[model samples]
Target: MGTTRTIKNKHAANGSGIKGSKASKNGPVNDGVIKAKKNAGTRAPIPGSGVKGRPNLADILKKRKKRVYSEKELGLPQLNMVTPVGVQKPRGKKKGKVFVDDRESMATILAIVQAEKDGQIESKMIKARQMEEIREARRAEADKKESERKAKLEETKDSLRKKRKRPRAGGKTQDDDVNGFEAVKALAAEGTKAAKPKKKRVSFAAD
Candidate 1:
């Protein structure tokens, strides 16, 4: 009789001897493995890779239509892009008429005068106001007289212009009067004829 030998199968084990489920959650993962995953598709073509001759993940993904690429990643020259800034237009200044109220100033002046104990100052202010009023009245009267004078002068000029434009009377001589008297004498000698009726004029177009 022959001795029976046991054989181990290599395909029976799915992974490394370490079980992922049984592994400690707080344990540190391999830095090289983590780094390899992060830098899988982002590696530049300048330096040599530690691995054998193999295409990068980026190179494989670039063939796919859904992948977006940058200039640096595609090994193209970088473009200088300028961002547009919004500019506000300057507004025009309003040219408005500014009206000043003298009520406050007058009130302040009144208050100052009242605060002073001198009666002479008050009387002087009153006299100044009365003088101003009289001056204004005189100015108004002068303006009115000047306006009336201008109106009268204009009327006189208009009358002179109308006279210049008026037609002169006819210059009848003695010979013209003699001729007129002879014509009247001839008409008186002749018998009066029947007046002819005037013909009617057509006022509208025929339909």
Candidate 2:
């Protein structure tokens, strides 16, 4: 029993890394922690496995959301399948407005300011045409109003130039003058005429 105990302890029982001895707790090697490491070589790939050591990709795709694919979109290409070959992203392109480094010189800016001060900022023929049109419209409107006023003045002058009214044509003549009693009698007659309806006489002819 003493010799057997020495033989057991001779093989790195204190984790000193001796031969035929396993690593201990907190040792460099953990062979002692594994139980069935003996004859435990790397597992061979499953029969006819497309990807070694991994489950079938077709089974995974079947479990996912099903999608209909065309022959063109699902064709097998004669290129590297797993590793990417070249640039994946597309080339950069301009999106919207771009800035330019070209700037106006001081001489050009000064010339522009001077031209503006001279009231000739730039020869805008369009604006000149528009202003002419506005002037023409205003002139036409003024001419229309002036013609109407002139005709009205001419009509008034023609009316005033006519001969005076005759005294018999219901004017303020001596025949139209009346006393207070006559005026009252005329008003009473007018009131009676307005209040009564005129009767029509019906003549009967007998055979």
Candidate 3:
């Protein structure tokens, strides 16, 4: 019994000591932790490191390059600078005036202002007599054409009614006058009498 107890203790000790022996020989160190600390320090200064203040409008405008244009530039009006697409500029007021661009619109407005300064009336009116004459002419033309068309339609209907009422060849007519059985019998008798020869009247002469 004492020898068996000693053998079981030796087996348990051998099993537990193997893992601790291997770990002592090749365990990992703290190099990975040190490297991670160094990386965190380098990344801390990267944020908010560039362009720290508000932008100056004057400085930006001064730094922008200026575009050169000659006196006779293509597709541009002589007086006004050309705006980019989708930018709408204000125009001046004038009667019967249209604008191709800002310059032309401004010119038209100035002309209207000058005219108003000279105390000219800007509104125009149509003559009442001319308007009445035009209205009367249109009414007369419409009435004449309408009457002519109605007459033509009525004539066409009348001709159609006449054609419908007319009798065809070898067909019965309303004027033929044979309507009932009595009229038919009378006609038959008259036809027979006319077809027969008439007898001459015999006269006895006294000597």
Candidate 4:
């Protein structure tokens, strides 16, 4: 039979399992922050310290900035460029006058322009003559109608005059007419002359 002897010993050091070596005062921290650390510093190294060839670990997080550009900074020209308040830029360049070097082409253009002007003038004269002829024809027709109206009026007047001068049926107007005082006296004198002297002549012849 064999008896085995085992002796156990207790350690006095901290048993923390964190990694990496302690760094400078303002160095980056990886194992979360110590709320109570304040401005205080720690000197104890982590249990599983240095990684052979690397420096102390750092966990850095930086914010990304948005890009900005001015009109001058833009690569292409900007049509919507805003002018600064109370400031005016220079005006655009003026256009130069164009000179024609070919005199033959210019002369041809002038001849075409003259032909167009002459055609327009002749057409206007012909239109004016046609309008005048139309007005003259209307006036002559109006004058003819007026002459016919006057002739009709004259015929009506002549017919009325003839109607007034024409004789009617009866012819014995003097005998059946009523006598005035002068006609009665003339008739009585003729009757007295015819009745008195003839009786005395008849008596002498009988004796």
| Candidate 2 minimal-lDDT segment of 10 residues | 198-207
Residue pairs of candidate 2 with colliding backbone atoms: none
Tell me the deviation in Å of residue 136 in model 1.
0.4
Cα RMSD (Å) per model? 26.6, 23.7, 29.5, 28.3
Candidates 1 and 2: which is better by TM-score?
1
Write the residue-wise lDDT of candidate 4 on 121-148 in tens digits: 9999999999999999999999999999
Model 3 bad stretches (over 4 Å): 1-126, 168-207
Q: Model 1 compared with the native: what TM-score?
A: 0.26
For TM-score, candidate 1 versus 3, the one ahead is: 1
Backbone collisions counted per model: 0, 0, 0, 0
lDDT of 3: 0.42
For each candidate, what is the lDDT?
Answer: 0.40, 0.41, 0.42, 0.40
Model 1 agreement with the true structure over 36-56: per-residue lDDT tens digits: 333343453222233423345
RMSD of 2: 23.7
